[model samples]
Target: MKYCAANYQFSFHSVNMRRMNDLRGIDLNLLVVLEALLAERHISRAALRLHLSQPAVSHALGRLRQLLDDPLLVRGQGGLVPSARAHELAGPLAEALAQVRILLGPSGFQPATARRSFRLAMSDYGAMALLPGLLRAVRKIAPGIDLVVSQASREAMTAKVADGEIDLALGVFGQPPEGVHSTELFEETYACMVDAATVRGLGKLDQVAYLARSHVLVATHSERVDAIDAAVAKVGGRRKIACVLPHWSVAPALIAGTNLVLTTARRSLAAFEEDPRFAVFDPPFPLPGFGFSLIWHDRTDADPGHSWLRERVIAVAAGDEPDDAISLRS
Candidate 1:
């Protein structure tokens, strides 16, 4: 059934007299419970969503039924079915509560004391570059805050951010999806990693020497063609792509003992800068660099916790300790 503001207000008026008499008893928390109850349609399921005991949820439902003078949900064979009044309130109630969340904001995020979990999406390369220091900072200060990181394609990550499935994402982006905002964290350029032993103690590759060896490609699925490939085209030769994989983390292992060339972000090979077995060098050809960024939906922009997390991420990207948060932009 299609719900409208007019219909929702009309239903609210039916109980307005009773609510007006007992206005003091109408709790926002109770309404929150009602929203979950209406959404779950099962006492136990609602309790799980709210992190409350089943009896507690039942008590809240009892109070809600008394306040609204309607048995919002009734027993059904499957679970609980919403009554006419509940159907009327469901859509509008959810809409109103969403607005209320935006209105109140996150209040404030006290990372030292907060017991919250955040979900972030990024590629394996992003994880390699950002996770080490970010994790250390989280452990030192925000012990109560937990992070869950997952990897997916840029399109999947952006879609998840838009749908509220993922809180934040970090990567190089082309054009972000609608309602998503992105800020550049840092700039990265293409670099070639090769087995130093086979490359004859060379710190860099010449144009002819670069195309002679087999290459390990990190196909991000964002694009098949990149700046180096364009550069190689200008020189009238193609890279011998012996292996094409989707992850940057595994490239080092593949290029360690073989005469394989892996061209990827400089940060991807930064950890191996000191390793004598590997040589991370600039390509002989000129390749345009890309800006790595952090992206999240506008829905999370004002959230204090999310903003705090974004600060920490940006701080890490800038090679700063996350002890004090920095806001690059308002």
Candidate 2:
């Protein structure tokens, strides 16, 4: 496998050196634009993904074609089709871009001086119980950071997370969508919340006593039959559903003067335990607790700021304490 002539070896080495020099002369940003274009296979979609104008991406493509001396892309049935050279470049280009991203990532996170805002989605109960401690920690350590919390249905929240609309979501995720990643944050057991006045003789609920009274359920939708129903079914009984309410805040007040009983997370009734008007008790039947998890996309997996915040959230959840940000009431 030797070169037949010394002249042929010399020519090969010269061409290879010039090719390496030519690659070094191209802009890094143009490679980024090329990666997106090859991926999306359409000018408009690539532009949207890069947050760049269509004219700018088109112009970049023109430059790429000239530099590579290849057509790069040709129109086809669905969208732009990559040339043979473009196909050859696709795999290597993507891997190179990924390496570049890692090379340029933040060396480390400085929570004390970093200014960032993250959008978090959770339920009303979650906000009351978890936000106080998390807010306290953030204020004491990272005063420049901000958290915007909101509520959405599980389905909608999953979609928002996949699309990068929501930075994180804390909730009971049975099975999260494909594009997002999730990890267990904590677990919570159910408890029955009711007024103390009418429960002297019927304090501890057996199945009969539990089902005898009217119950008000807190759910985003009435069609959701939760664990309570499944447990009740196993016991061969069903509780009377007097009403289905959306928010947990209003359910306790609604049960104050009526026979309505509210079944909810035990931690949610923390402030109401010692109050004269309320009572918290274990469910008459056995019901498994739910695993609350943190949902986020893989795009933020290596971000220094996001990693720091995630650890803080897990710490707060483990050692939850109330802060002045919110107050629980009857």
Candidate 3:
């Protein structure tokens, strides 16, 4: 009687083992192809969406059939009709995929506690104007996280964010590239800068006095000069652009002892605004109030660390100044 009971248990265990093996041998990629097929109901369209050729999609479907032991998709007068088994599997498979995505997606980032290294690309002016406040906030909050800041050319900035060469970018920018997100940090008009020593010695500047002085233009490619030219055109004037620099950080040092005047963001010039050696003025005509933004790749949108970094940068760059201090710094 003991031997009879043992033989019965062994038979049940063997059957269970075979079922587990059948499930284990099913390829996950094939499941994904099946999900796509179930959605589109057209092989060619699903192939294009998955970036696979039509033949590859068909091969995956063949493997899916052998594993599932069913003609999962059947062609009918109305197009492909999912078999009853396919309909049953679809709901559970989709639910399982959703759960998997939630489990494997990026972790939640906490700025005050997280340890991470954030990469950023920006001009020197952007770095000087924005980074100090951001660094202060980081040191106070996420001190464990390090920041890697790099210089980027105008042409390469958008592509760098898109390709993940950098995690985020800060600058005066136009439209963001596809697959990127941008949040406006601040907007301030341009201010004309001059050496206080030169202005003091040469006397105060009127519109003519401004145009007569030499200019130090920050040209990000040649179009910058043209933009400046058009801004000055209303005054029946053109600047004598004696010096050109790629960034605002160097512009301050260059203008310190020279007669050359530069035009830049008020935020960029904030540090120098109170200094005795520099003078700031409004341009002859409005030189377009451009927006400074914090931009990042869409792929990083769900990443906790990336989100934290972007949030802090925006907060600081926006100047989160208290409403009690409503007086504009005129």
Candidate 4:
């Protein structure tokens, strides 16, 4: 039976009144006993269904009688007859139980059948490396879905995820504040990128050659220039820092036609592939490898659409070609 809002309000008010003027207080467990009592009719059978002793069922029935101001069940030739009052409550109570079931039930999410906007935050390098493949893969699966990508500062990232302001985050940082989950997307090796023409004119880069040439560094929030100094100290070297850039994305354009060698993620080098002037080569000395990851709120952990999006991101991170049947990134 369909339950209207008016009927639900009336039923709730009726139950509330009985509780206000009850014998001391009403036991909510009495509703379970009342349900079983109305279903089975016999006290022993109601007790069996409720997993209560017969005496306990009888005691609950007594309290229910006083609370409802009705016998609730009457012994008749039919075994037990529900009082008119009990029959009156049956429909509304059943509807209430069913509403709760629907609230907690499993949800169906079909990407092709859904139109949802996913908001994501990541650094420009992260976007350059993963978004092209990620977007292509998702389009094959969910043509109608939309994506909103934006740059986010570390100070605001965790709060944005917690408030559902952003769906996911991808970057080199890890260990988000409590209530966020993170997974390693991939490990990134750094390479020195410079103009191929310039490198040929300058000859092979040695410690002295590297020190003599101007260098561009992505400053961000790290003391990376000092770290480079310490790492190359054993080899008796120093680098002449010519510029400090705020983001890795800006380095490509700054060194596009110059002799300045800038270090950046190899995966991100794809952004500069179209420029023939630029070339990526291994650093002559050892450098740190950056590991990027995807982060999201725990609340979205079991959501089907969010899970699907997260999996696609991981696939893109693993260097998968989106058109193939089996994504290599997986």
Candidate 5:
């Protein structure tokens, strides 16, 4: 069938206007319940998450289904599953709620007395370098705040942040994806870490020795190649990869008695600095390093709680007092 472009555009605009007008009559709180229901995918679980009675959540779900003109969820063999329309609404709903939270302003945040949970997406390197100081500061000041750390690929991090699943992401991102906002936390340099015994026998590592020896590669989420490999290729060299591990925390134990050399961010060395088993050195060939950034969605840019957390993160990363952290709003 043929279609007229102008007629189609007018119909789309009218439908959107009708939806907006319908939205004006619905209790805005239903959106919150819809978000929880979509995420939990079960009425009881959504109620528990929202701290509401099951009946209240069910009622809200009914209202949501009517408003959106879809059975947003239904029983499945595995308890419950979101309908196609529910899946479609999930991302935009989350974004809209985040915007509403931001619009309410920062008056809701009271770190000293607030009990809040923050989910952070970061690599093991970032967690190691930042968490120790962040935890200490949190305990001293915002004792009621809790942190949940998770790992995500660069691709996943952008979506997670935009959808309000991750409150912040910490990592080396050369260019942030659209809709993601970021601030440079610090610049990092690569360093070689080896067992003291191995380094003692080999002395200072040169390009020849570096390429000849077996190495342990630390791989982050969804990253098959790392900076070390790229640097080697740039210098027209290659090394034997003895093992591949996911987290930086395991690198020390893996390198303890082996001849394997590990190359990682210099700041990460602080964790193993005093350990007698490890030695740190500069790579024989110059390796490319990265700048770490604190990433978040623009929706949370003006949120006082998020802003306060960002300040703490910046302070921890920069080794400054929490009081000294700069305000993003300013």
Candidate 6:
């Protein structure tokens, strides 16, 4: 005869059949009673601890002796003493009970005292737009919490979340992967950045001037087409690509001395607001903005720590306070 256990098929032979049957008939709650009885020794004390009658405790002890095939407790000169097998089971039984208590108890996450480290996967652009505020908020509230950020491609974020490699991911996911939950944080629009000294006669760039100028393509990953390029293509226009780079950080410095224009997310331009060398303007065409979402696996959906982290991320993205206990930095 074949039996299925956790997707595996195995045959039970005569040698182990009784052990499996014993396990099937075992009541897990009896372990709790056994643990209490072993700790208290006396039936009355054990009943008090377990909120049961003395007779109930004695009956449970009788069941325990039959299960173990040994008298767990016996009378001695001073008081009830543990048998050899009971003494052998005490240490491991105590450890297992402690683990079960923790598993059954509340998650017990206190942000003020929690010393947790979380790994996040996001594109460089998303990090640039969100990290400064997120770090500030986290530092003031969860001072003990730590964050590790990684740059993952759009294709890899879903797998990273599902495999427990990344706790959360932030990006413009048009179609999120199956089994992943996402909440839209905000809609992000594009802006054209240029050097004030190098570019002239461009107050608000028209499609004609936008396409005529050389552009620095901020391709953080090796994708062939970006949002701006796709938008321009829809309108039967294309910008001249002078160079392609892997990060948004280098685009400002590269565009400062040259006539190259960089088109990227509007939130990313906040870093260059006070810099006299860079100029920010709206994109020439009416390009559709993309929505940024916080994505996590279903496995973490009900976890208290994971829920707290997601709330913080959403609050920071929405430019609001996390809670009354925590305040955002100016």
TM-scores of all candidate predictions against the true structure:
0.70, 0.66, 0.62, 0.60, 0.78, 0.66
Q: Which regions of candidate 1 are displaced past 4 Å?
A: 1-107, 324-330
User: What is the per-residue lDDT of model 1 for residues 1-330, given as tens digits with 9 covering 90 to 100?
Assistant: 357877988888878866667748668798888877765679997787677899999999998898788999999998989899987776567546555765764456667776656668899989998998888887777888878787888887887676555679998777997789999999998888888897775676898888887788788785767677888898898988898888888888998778888888998888888898888888888788899999998777867777788888888999999664533222
Whole-model lDDT, candidate 6? 0.76
For 76-105, candidate 4 gives per-residue lDDT tens digits of 986789878887775455334334333543
Q: How many clashes in each candidate?
A: 0, 0, 0, 0, 0, 0
Q: Report the Cα lDDT for residue 190, model 4.
A: 75
Highest-scoring model, lDDT: 1
What's the residue-level lDDT of 298 in candidate 1?
Answer: 77
| Segments of candidate 5 deviating more than 4 angstroms | 1-27, 36-83, 105-108, 201-203, 221-223, 324-330
Ranking by lDDT: 1, 5, 2, 6, 3, 4
Superposition TM-score, candidate 5 onto the true structure: 0.78
Q: Could you give candidate 3's per-residue lDDT for residues 1-330 as a string of tens digits?
A: 999999999999998779658757667788778877875677986686577899999999998898778999989876688899997776566546544543664455455555555667888878887788888877777777877677777557776666554668887667887877888888768887888987776534677778888888887665655566787886678888888877677777888778788876777787877888888777767578777777877666766566656667767776762222122110
lDDT of 2 by residue, 1-330 (tens): 365677789999999779758867778899988877775679997787677899999999998998788999989999999899997786567546545654675576666776766668998877877888898888887898878787988887786666555668888776877767898888899899777777876665667878899898888755758788888889998878998878877777888887678888888888888887777789988888988888887666666667777777887888954242431111
Per-model CA lDDT versus the true structure: 0.80, 0.78, 0.73, 0.72, 0.79, 0.76
> Mind giving the per-residue lDDT tens digits that candidate 6 earns over 81-175?
88889877765674465455446646655677766566688887788878888888788878888787878777787766654556699987767
- Candidates in order: C-alpha RMSD to true structure: 7.9, 10.2, 16.0, 20.1, 5.6, 16.4
lDDT of 2 at 27: 83
Give candidate 4's root-mean-square deviation (CA, Å).
Answer: 20.1
Q: Could you tell me which 10 consecutive residues in candidate 6 have the lowest summed lDDT?
A: 1-10
Query: How many pairs of residues collide in model 5?
Result: 0
Q: Candidate 3 deviates by what RMSD? A: 16.0
